[model samples]
Each structure stands twice: as C-alpha cells, then as structure tokens.
Target: MKVAMIGAGYVGLVSGACFSEFGHQVVCVDVDERKIRMLEQGEIPIFEPGLEKLVADNVAAGRLSFTRDLTGAVADAEAVFIAVGTPSRRGGGEADLSYVYQAARDIAGATEGEKVVVTKSTVPVGTGAEVRRILAETNPGATFHVVSNPEFLREGAAIEDFMRPNRVVCGVESKHAEQVMRELYRPLFLNETPMVFTSLESSEMIKYAANCFLATKITFINEVADLCERVGADVQAVARGIGLDRRIGNLFLHPGPGFGGSCFPKDIRALAATAESAGAPLRIVETVNDINESRKKAMAAKIIDAMGGDVAGKTIAVLGVTFKPNTDDMRESPSLDIVPALQQAGATVRATDPEGVREAKELLTDVVWCEDAYTAMEGADAVAILTEWNHFRALDKGRMKKLLKQPLMIDLRNIYPVDEMEKAGFRYVSVGRRAVGN
Candidate 1:
C-alpha cells in the first residue's frame, strides 16, 4: 500500500510513520518546507514518545519519507489522507475547515486515476460531502472517493493509540474506498481491532461525540471536586468509589485546573455549534465547555488563597506547565490561564517542565523559566503542581522545604497525600482534599 499523508503536522507525521511501520510506503506531504527539511534530517519537530524512533526505523527501511511536493506525493499514492488542522473559528465555535477544503482542492488537482481520499482530520458532519463537492468542482473528470476517517489519537500517547487503537472507524460509501481502507489497516486485523464501518456523517459525528463525551466526564469530575471541597469530602476517594463501576470506568476522572488540549476545548465548542445549527442544541456539551473554561480560570485564585490571600510580592513556583505529561503540547493548557492570572495578582511565576520549556517559552512571557522543578522551587513563596508530570510525582520533601522560601504547597493535580504532607510539617493545599494541611 502506498499512502500520501497531506499535512506533516502531528496527525500526519504519526499516522504516516505508523502506516509505513505496517509495511506500507508512506510519503508525508507538508506545505511547510522547513518541516519537511526537519523530518528529512531526522530532527522530529514535535515531541512524542516513541515517535522519533518509529519514524527513524521506518525511514531507514525505505518505508517512510517526507516531501513538500504535494502533487508528486499524491499522484503516486493509492490512499491520500487529509490530516490538516481544523481550528475553531474566531469569535465563534464553528470549525474553520478552510485547511481541509484547501487540501481537498489540492488533492483534486494532483490525484491521478481512481484514488481514495480519506479525511484523517477531525471535522464536522457534512464535511465529507463538501469535500466530495470540492473534488468534483475542482476536477470534473477526476475520480475521487472522499472517505471520512477521523483520528482518535491522544497527544502524549499518539503512537501507542495509533498502533494499538481500540477500534478503527471509517465512513466509506463506495466499495473501492472501503476495500482500500481495509487493506490500509490490514495490519490491525491481526490484533482483531474492531473496524467500524459507518456513513460519512456518522463517522464525523463519532469523532466529535467521543471527544465531547470525554470533555463532559472531565467537567463532571471537576464540578464534583468543587462540591467535595465544600462538603468536606475527599474527591480522590469519591473518584475511586465511582470509577469501580463498570459504566464509569474512570479515565478522565482526575480533578485538575481544567481540560485543555488540541482537541477537547475546540471539539466541544464545535460540536455545540454544529448541533445548534442543525436545530438540536446540546446543552450538556455547551455547559461542559463553559464550566471547563471557568475551572481553568479559577485555579489561579485558588493558588493565591492557598498562599495566604496576597501574593503581591511573592514568587510562586509552578511545577508543570504542559497540558499533560509525556508531551510538550502547550495549547490551551491550564498554565496559560493560571500563570497570567497570578502575574495579574503581582506574583512572579517560576516555572519548569521536563519537556514543555521549549514550547512554553514561546507561549508564556516574562516568567522566570528554570532548568528543573527544584530550580523553580528555589526562593519561591509557594509551589504549585499544575500538571502531573512524572518527575514531579516523587520529590524529597525535606529538599523541597529547604529550597522554598516557605513550606507552602499547592497540589492542583492532587498528586500528594494530605496526611503525608501534613506529617512532613508543611502547609499543603490540594484539590478536593482536606484544607491546608499542617
């Protein structure tokens, strides 16, 4: 199988590499020449666990390649995948599908013979129809079958998710496209991965629905964490109790600042807007979006309150700044909200992340970026663990106490036990746990 992956961004790079690893020849096409150059030079532009090795192994085996020549890549490929970004529209929740549409037009011009054009980007319900329309309008005589095949890869664990996905969903109306898809994912058949075949619209809906539902679960738990705090209850125990139920199963039940990433924030808003446009609004999803935003914003104030209400002349140490661990992605991260708010309260933020410093340096400004968590903790009034990175999971309590100006700690991710911190003789604050342990 020969695959031309359009857009060598996160999705395209990972998917193309994985497909090539499955013994298929893959050429990742990107409009960005620098990105192509980087890939060719074996300098992975993004930080994903095992992705660098996977791409390198496949490229060494002559199974994977990268190019900015879209036409050359698309013309020789049997399956052309559109994996471009569809960001939320400005001042509106609708997805701006201009990139997806432009890719469709480009694919239409470059496609030779009968080609299966699969959309690997997360898009709206009627997007495939529009893509089909674009293909026909752009090249009236061309034969193109547009298939909606949205990706379900998690950021930090994208490679694992791609290689060992629970299921593969494809929106294929034509037999030829279905056959091509089946052959493309033939490697997964060995593992008996469920292949969901649905209509184009259903496939598109599935992606949004899945993301929004997970976002809802996060929001629900966050709200419960708030309630647990007010009612003198421990949210960790609460989460564990409910997570044992088969229905809940506890994935996104961890209470934190809020949900922020490439997918959740935009996907939920886009779904809400799409549903409203279709004359059936999703109130729960809409509320989830609103609540998550508020949750992220509220975390800064919580930190300030934990630090004795006035951080006007204080220096606060932020342990992690990325959205999650194992990835350097800073898009919509809770630190974006909390850091700025803390600065507004006249506090100096000393932050450190094992992998996020490079990207965070670009998004965050005027903060004192440090080499490590201990460096950030040095001379700070209080320390806050915003993202639960593994490095922050275990630290010397006595060393932390010695480094910090005071023994004040805020564990937003609930990474520490209240009793242990209390016994350690430090003033500890955590989410939905006992208040201000000493």
Candidate 2:
C-alpha cells in the first residue's frame, strides 16, 4: 500500500513511520522544508521514545521517505491521510480546522484516481462531511472517499500505542473504502487488534470522548487528592483499592498537579464548544476544565504553605517541567502555570529535567537550568517534584536533604512514601496524602 501522510508533525511522523514499518510505502509530507530536510538526513525534529531508530531503519530500508511536495506525494498514493493540527481557536473553544480544510483542497486538486482521504487528526463531528464537500467543490469530477480514522497515540509511548493499539476505529461510507482500510491495517488485524467500523460522526466523537473521559479521570483523582489531604488519608492506597476492582482499572488515576498535554486540554474545550453549538452543553466537561485550572494554582499554594508561608525571596528547586515523563514535549504542561505563579509570589525558581529543558527554556524564564535533580536542589529552600521521571524515583534522599538549604520536600506526584521521607528527616508534603512533620 502507498500512503501519503500530510503535515509531518507528531501524528504524521509517527503514523507514517509505523505504517512504513508495516511494509507500506509511506511519504511523510510537511510544509516546512527545513523539517523535511532534517528527516532526509536521518534527523528527527521531535523527541519520542524509539521513534528515531524506527524512522531511521525504515528510511534505510527504502520503505519510508519525507518530502515537501504535497502534490507529488498525494498524486501517487492510495491513501492520503490528513494528519495536520487542529489547534484550539483563540477566544473560542472550537478546534480551528483551517489546516484540515486546506489539505483537502490541495489533495482534491492533486489526486488522479480513486483515493481514500483519511482524517487522522482529532476533529469535531461532521468534519469528514465538510472535507467531502470541500473536495467535491474543488474537483467536480474527482472520485474520492473521506474516512474518519482518529489517532489515539499518547506522547512518550506513541510508537508502542500505534504498533499495538487495543483497537482501531474506522469510519467509512462504502464497502470499498472499508476493504482498503482493513488491508492497510492488516498487520494489526493479524495481531488481533479489533477494528470498530462506525459512522464518520461517531468516529470523530470517539476521539474527543476518549480524551475528555481520561481528562475527567485525572481531574476526579486530583479532587480526591485534595479531600485526602484535608481528611488525613492516602490517595495512593485509595487509588490502589479502587483500581483493583475489575470494572475500574487504574491507568490515569494518579494524582498530580493536573492533566496537561497536547490532547486533553484542547479536546475537552473543543468538545464543550461542539456540544454548545448543538444546543446541548457538556456541563461536566466545563466543570472539569475549571477544576483542572484551579488545581494547578492550588498546587503552587501548597508549595508555598510547605515552605512555612510566603515564598518571597526564596530559591525553590523544581524537578520535571514536562507534562509527563519520557517525552520532551512541553505543550500545556502544568509546570507552565505553577512555575509562573511561584515566580509571581517572589520565589526564584531553579528547574531541571532529563529532556524537557530544551523546550522548557522557551516557556519558562528567569530560572536556572541545572545538570541534575541534586544540582537543581542545591542551595534551594524547597524541592518540588512536578513530573515523576524514572530517575526521580530512586533519588538519594539523604543527599538531597544535605544539599537543600531547607529540608522541605513537596512530592506532588507522590513519588515517595510519607514514612520514608519522615525517616529521612525531611518535612514532606504531597497531594491527597497526610503531611508528615511540622
């Protein structure tokens, strides 16, 4: 199968590479000539686990390629995937579908024969029909089918998720389009990954619904963490107790600063807008967005309170700036909100991350970037763990205690047990758990 993937961003690059790895010929198209040039030289523009090696291997085998020529790529492809970004529009919570529409117009002009145009980006309901209308208007005699195939890959684990997804949801209007999609995903079919065939609107709604539900789960746990703090309970044990139930599996149940990444925040807001436009507002989703924002501000206050009130003129060490561990992506990270708030309260922030510093430098200012966690803690009044990276899990507690000017440890991710931090002779504060030491 020949696949032309439009937009070469995170979704396009990962999906194109994975498709090539499955023995399909894939050309990843991007508007940025610089990015395409970088890929041609075996260089990846973004940081993703195992993506670099996979892309390099596929390119070496001549199964994958990159190009800036969108027309040339689409003209010879069996499936043209519109994987462009639909960023949230300013002042309105709706997803801006300008990129998706532009791609459809270009593909309609370039396509020669029957082609499957797949919407691989997370979009609102009826977006596929809009694409269909755009193509029909652009090319009066063109024969093409618009299919909805929303991506479900998470950052840091995108490659694994793409290669071994639990199921693949595809929306097609015709049996011919369905057969092509099934054959294209034959590798996953062999692996027994179920494929759900549904209407275009249902597939579009599925992506937003999944992301919003996950965001709600994280928010619910965060609120529970706050209650746990007031009632002197442990959120970790609470999460475990409920997670053990067969019906309620634990995945995004960990309490943290809040849910912040490329997907959840924007998708939830867009879904709310979609609901409102249709005369049915999503009240719970609207509340989830409000509560999540408050959670981030509240976390900053918790850190200040742990420092014996007033962080004025204090040097605070922050660990992990990325939304989560294992990826360098800093999009909508909770640290973006918390760090600025700390600075506003007159605290000089020092931060360190394994890979996020490069991107973090753009969003965060007036912070000293350190070589390691201990370096970040050196001479700081308090240390706060914002992201639970693997390196942070087994830190030398005694060494950290010795390095910090004040032995105040705020484990926002609950990386350490209260008894352990207390035994190490440090005052500990964590989310949804009893505070240890005075």
Candidate 3:
C-alpha cells in the first residue's frame, strides 16, 4: 500500500515510519523546510524512544521518506493521513484546526484517484465532516473518503504502542473507506489487535473522552492523597486496596503534582468547551482541569512548607522537569508552574532532566539548568522529585544527602518508601504518606 502522511510532526513521522515498517511505502509531507531537511539528514526533531531507529531502519529499507512537496506526495499515494497538530485555541478549549483545514485543501488539490484521507490527529468531533466538506469544495467531484482515525500512542512508548496497540479505531461512513483502512492495518490482523469500526464523530469523541477520563483519575488520586494526609492514612495503601478491585484497576491512580502533558490538559479543556457549547457541560472534567492547574502551583507551597514555611533564600533541586520520563516534551509540564512558583516565593531553582533540558530551557526562565541529577542537587537546600524518570527512581540517597546542605527530600511522585527514607536517617516528605525522619 502507498500512503502519504500530511504533517511530519510527531504523529505523522511516527505513524509514517511504522506504516513503512509494516511494508507500506509512505511519504511524510511537511511545509516546514527545516524539519523536512532534518528528517532527510537523519536528524529527528523530536525525542521519542526508539523512533530514530524506526525511522532510520525504514528509510534504509526504502519504504519511508520525508518531503516538503505535498502535491507530489499526495498524488502518488492511495491514502493521505492528516496528522497535523490541533492545539487549543488562544484562551479557549476549541481546537485550532487551521493546519488541519489547510491540509485538507492541499490534499484535495493534490490527491490522485480514490484516496482515503485519514485524520490521525486529535481533533474535536465534526472535524472529519468539515474536512470532507472542504475537500469537496476544493476539488469538485473528487472521490475522497475522509476518516477519523485518532492516534493513541504514548510519547515514551510510541513505537510499541503503534506496533502492538490495544486496539485500532477507524471511523468510516462507506465500505470503500473501511476496506482501505483494514488493508492499511492488515498487519494488526495477524496480531489479533481488535479493530473498532464506528462513526466519525464517535471516533473523535473517543480520543478526547479517553484522555479526559485519565486526567480525572489522576486528579481523583491527587485529592485522595491530600485526604489521606489529613486523616492520617496512606494513599499508596488506599490506592493499592482499591486498585485490586477489577472495576477500578490501577493505572493513573498514582498521585503526583498533577497531570500535565500534551494530551490531558488540551483534551480536557477542549472536551469541556465542546460540552459547554452543546449545553451539556462536564462539571467533573472542568473541576479536574481547574484542580490540576492549581495542583502544580500548590506543589511549590508543599516544598516551601517542607522548608519550615519559608523558601526565601533557599535553593531547591528539582529532578525531572519533563511531564513524564523518556521524552523531551515540556508542553504544560507541572515543572513549568512549580519551578516559577518556587522562584516567585524567593527560592532559587536548580533543575535537570535526562532529555527535557533542551526544551525546558525555552519554557522555564531564571532557573539554573544542570547536566545531571546529582549536579542539580549539589549545594541545594532540598531535593524534590517532580517527574519519575527511571534514574531518579533509584538515586544514591547517601550521595544526595551529602550533596544537599540539609538532608531534606520531597518526593512528589512518591517513588520512595517512607520507611526506607526513615531508615536512611533523612527527612522525607512524600505525597499521600506521613512525613518521616523528622
């Protein structure tokens, strides 16, 4: 199968490379000349695990390629996937679909006979319908099938997720579109990955609903962590107990500074706005969004309180500034709020992440960036673990204690056990558990 991916950003690049790996000849198109040049030079712009290898392997096999020539790419393919970004509109939750619409128009003009247009980007419902309308209006009497095939790949584990997805969703109104999609993902058929067929609107809604629900779960657990602190209970124990129940299973139940990533915050706001427009506002989701935002700032207060209610003239080491581990994405990371809040409260911040510093440096200001975790902690008053990066999970407690001016630790991700910290003879403050080693 021949596929043309419109937009060589994260979704398009990954999906295009994976499709090529599946024996499909894929051409990834992008308007950004610099990005396309980078891809062609074997320099990936994003920091997704194993993505560079995947792209390199496929390109070497002559199954995948990148280009800025949208017309040429689209004209040569049977399927055109719009994998552009639909970021939140300025000061609102409605998705900014300018890029998507532009792609539709370009694809409409460039597409050859019988092309299946798939929306692999996260979009609001009715977006596919609008794309279809734009395609028809752009090129009259063109045989194009627009599909809503929202991607569900996690950043750090995108390749694995794509190769072995829990399920593949396709929104098709016609048998032709359905068959084309099925053939494109025919490899998944061997793995027995469930194929969900639904309406365009349903497919779009599934992406938003899934992310919002996960955000809610994270927010719910964070609130529970607070309550556990007040009532002298352990949130970890409570979570474990509830997670054992089949109905409640234990993902996204771990408490932290809050959920802050590319998907959760954007999707929650978008869904909330969509619901409000439809006269069916989601109060719970709205509250979760509000709480999660406040929660990030509140984590700075927790650090202050750990320093005996004053962060003035204090130096705090923040390990892991990325939203999560194994990626350089700093979009809406909690550290964006927490670091600045700490600075506002007169605390000097020293932060480091394995892969996030390059991107984080652009968003975060007035903070000392370090090369590694230990370097960040050197001479700091206290150490705070923001993102649970793998190396931070088993850091040298003795070395951290020696490097810090005081033996104080705030484990926001609760990666450390309370009893172990107590045994280590260091003051440890963690979420959903009693402070140990006073």
Candidate 4:
C-alpha cells in the first residue's frame, strides 16, 4: 500500500509512521517547510513515546518518508489521508475546517487516478460531504472516493493505541473506498481489531462522542470527589467501589484538576455547539465543559486553603505542570489555569515536569522553573502534585520535608497514601479524601 498523508502534525506523523511500520509505504506531506525539513532530517517535532524510534526505524527500512510536495506524493499513492488539525474556532466552538478544505482542494488537484481520499482528521458531521463537494468542484473529471476515518490515539500512548486499537471506525459509502481502507488496515485484521463500518456522519460523531463521554466521566468523578470531601469519605474508595461494577469500569474515574488535552476540551465543545445547531442541545456536555473549566481554577483554591487560607508571599512547589503523565503536550492543561490563579493570589510558583517543562514554559509566565522535582520543592511553603509522573510517585519524604518551608503536600492526583504522608510528619490534602494533619 502506498499512502500519502496530507499533514505532518501529530495525527499525520504518528499514523504515517505506524502504517509504514506495518509494511506499507507512506509519504507524509506538510505545508510547513521547516517541519518537513525536520522530519526529513530524522528530527521529530512532537514528543510522543516510541514515535521517534518508530519513524527512524521505518525510514531506515525505506518504508516511510516526509515531503512538502503533496502533489508528487498524491500522484503515486493509492490512498491520500487528510490528517490535519481541526482546532476550535475563535467565536464559535465549531471545528475550524479551513485547513481540511484546503487539503481537499490540494488533493483534488494532485490526484491523478482513482484514489481513496480518507479524512483521518477528527472532523464534524457533514465534513466528508463538503470534502466530496470540494473535490467535485475542483476537479470534475477526477475519480476519487472520500472516506471518513477518525483517529483515536491518546497523546502519551499514541503508538500503542495505533498498533492495537480497540476499534477502527471508518465511514464510507462506496465499495472502492471500503476495500482500500480494508487493505490499509489488514494488519490489524490479523489481530482481530474490530472494524466499525458506518456512515460518514456516524463516524464523525463517534470521535466527538467518545471524547465528550470521557470528559464527562472525568467531570463526574471530580464532582464526586467534591462530595466526598464534604461527607468525610474517600473518593478513591468511592471510585474503587463503583469501578468494580461491570457497568462502571475504572478508566477516567481518577479525580484531579479536571480534564484538559488537545482532544477532550475541543471535541466536547464542538459537539455541544453542533448539537445546539441541530436544535437538539446536549446540556450534560455543555455543563461538562463549564465545570471542567471552573474545576481547573478551583484547584488553586484547594492549594490556597491548604496554605492557611492564603498564598500571599508564599512559594509553592508544583511537582508537575502537564495535564497528565507521559506526555509533554500543554494544550488546555490544568496548569494553565491553576498556576496563573495561584500567581494572582500572590503565590510565587515553582514548577517542574519530567517532560512538559519545555512546552509549559511557553504557556506559563512569571514562574520559577526547576531542573528537578526536589529542586522545585526547595524552600517552598507547600508541594502540589499536579501530574502523576512516574518519579513523583515515590519521593524521599525526609528530603522533601527538609526542602520545604512547610511540610505540606497537596496531592491532586492522589498519588500518595494519606497514612504514609501523616507518618512522614507532613500535612496532606488530597481530592476525594479526608485531610490529614491540617
């Protein structure tokens, strides 16, 4: 299979690399000349685990390549995948599809023969129809089939997700497009990865619906954590109790500073907007968006209350800044809200993350950056565990007490056991659990 990927962003790059690793020839195209050059030089722009190695290995095997010339790549390809970004629009929460439309036009002009044009981007419903319209208008004589194939890769675990997806949802109306898609994913077929064949609208809705439901789950747990705090119950125990039930398996049930990532926030907002536009508004999803936004800011108050109802003139060490562990992406990260709120409340913020610091630096301002987590804790009034990085899971309690101005630990991710922290002679505050030594 010869595939042309018409974008070199996260989805495009990861998908192309994974496809090539599956023994297919893939050429990834991007309009960013600098990004293309970087990819060509074996320099990946994003920080995804196992991605660089995969790209390098496939490139070495002459199976994967990068280019800025979409025309050249599309001419020789059997399938052209538009895996571009669909960031939220400014005024409305609708997905900005200009890039996708432009890619369609470019693909339409470049496609030489019968080719399956696949929308691997997370787009709104009716987008495939619009792309089909664009193709017909751009090239009346071209023979192409537009198929919607949404991606469902987690940021930190994209490679694993791609290789062993739970399911592959594809939207197609023609036999030619379906056959091309089947051939493209034949490797997964051997693994019995379920193939969900549906209409373009259903496939598009599936992507948004999945992310929105995950966001709702996070928000629900967060609210339950708040209730646990009031009722003198441990939210972790509650999560465990409910998670044991087959109806409510534990996945996004861990309570924290709410959900934030490239997909969840944008996808949920877009879904709400789309639903409202259709005159069938999703109130729960809309509320989830509001609650998650407010929850990020509320976490600052959690830290502030732990610091004797004030953070003025205090230096707080933030152990992690990224939304979650194992990824450096800071897009809509809770730290973006929590850090600034703490700063506004007159706290001097010292932050450290194993992977997110470089990207966090651009979004966060007026904060002290540290080389390591322990270094960030030095002379801080309290330590807030924002992200559950592997290293932060186990810490030298004695050293942390010696480094901090006050032996206070706010475990947002609930990484530490309350009894252990109390045994360590530190006041511990955590979500969905009773405080110790407050």
Given candidate 2, what's the lDDT at residue 309?
Answer: 86
Candidate 1, after superposition: displacement of residue 146 in Å? Answer: 1.3
Q: How high is each candidate's TM-score?
A: 0.99, 0.99, 0.99, 0.99
lDDT of 1 by residue, 1-438 (tens): 999999999999999999999999999999898899999999999999999999999999999999999999999999999999999999999999999999999999997668899999999999999999999999988898889998999998999899899899999989999999999999999999999999999999999999999998888889999999899999999999999999999788999999888999999999999999999999999999999998888999999998878999899999999999988999999999999999999999999999999999999899999999899999999999999998998889999999999998999999988888988888998988887654
lDDT of 3 by residue, 15-107 (tens): 999999999999999999999999999999999999999999999999999999999999989999999998999989888999999999999
Evaluate residue 345 in candidate 3 and report its C-alpha lDDT on the 0 to 100 scale: 91
Off by over 4 Å in 4: none
The whole-model C-alpha lDDT of candidate 3 against the native structure comes to 0.93
Report the Cα RMSD per candidate. 0.9, 0.8, 0.9, 0.8
Q: Predict model 1's lDDT versus the native.
A: 0.93
How well is each residue in 1-438 modelled by candidate 4, as lDDT tens digits? 999999999999999999999999999999899999999998989989999999999999999999888899999999999999999999889999999999999999997658789999999888999999999899988887989999999989999999999999999989989998999999998999999999999999999999998888899999999999999988999999999999989988999998888899999989999999999999999999999999998999999999999999999999888878888889999999999999999999999999988988889999999999899999999999999999899999999999998899999999999999999999999999989996
User: How close to the true structure is residue 345 of candidate 4, measured as C-alpha lDDT?
Assistant: 96
Per-model lDDT: 0.93, 0.93, 0.93, 0.93
In model 4, where is the ten-residue run with the lowest total lDDT? 108-117
The CA lDDT at 271 in model 3 is 93
Q: Look at candidate 3 and tell me the lDDT of residue 306.
A: 92
Q: By TM-score, how accurate is candidate 1?
A: 0.99
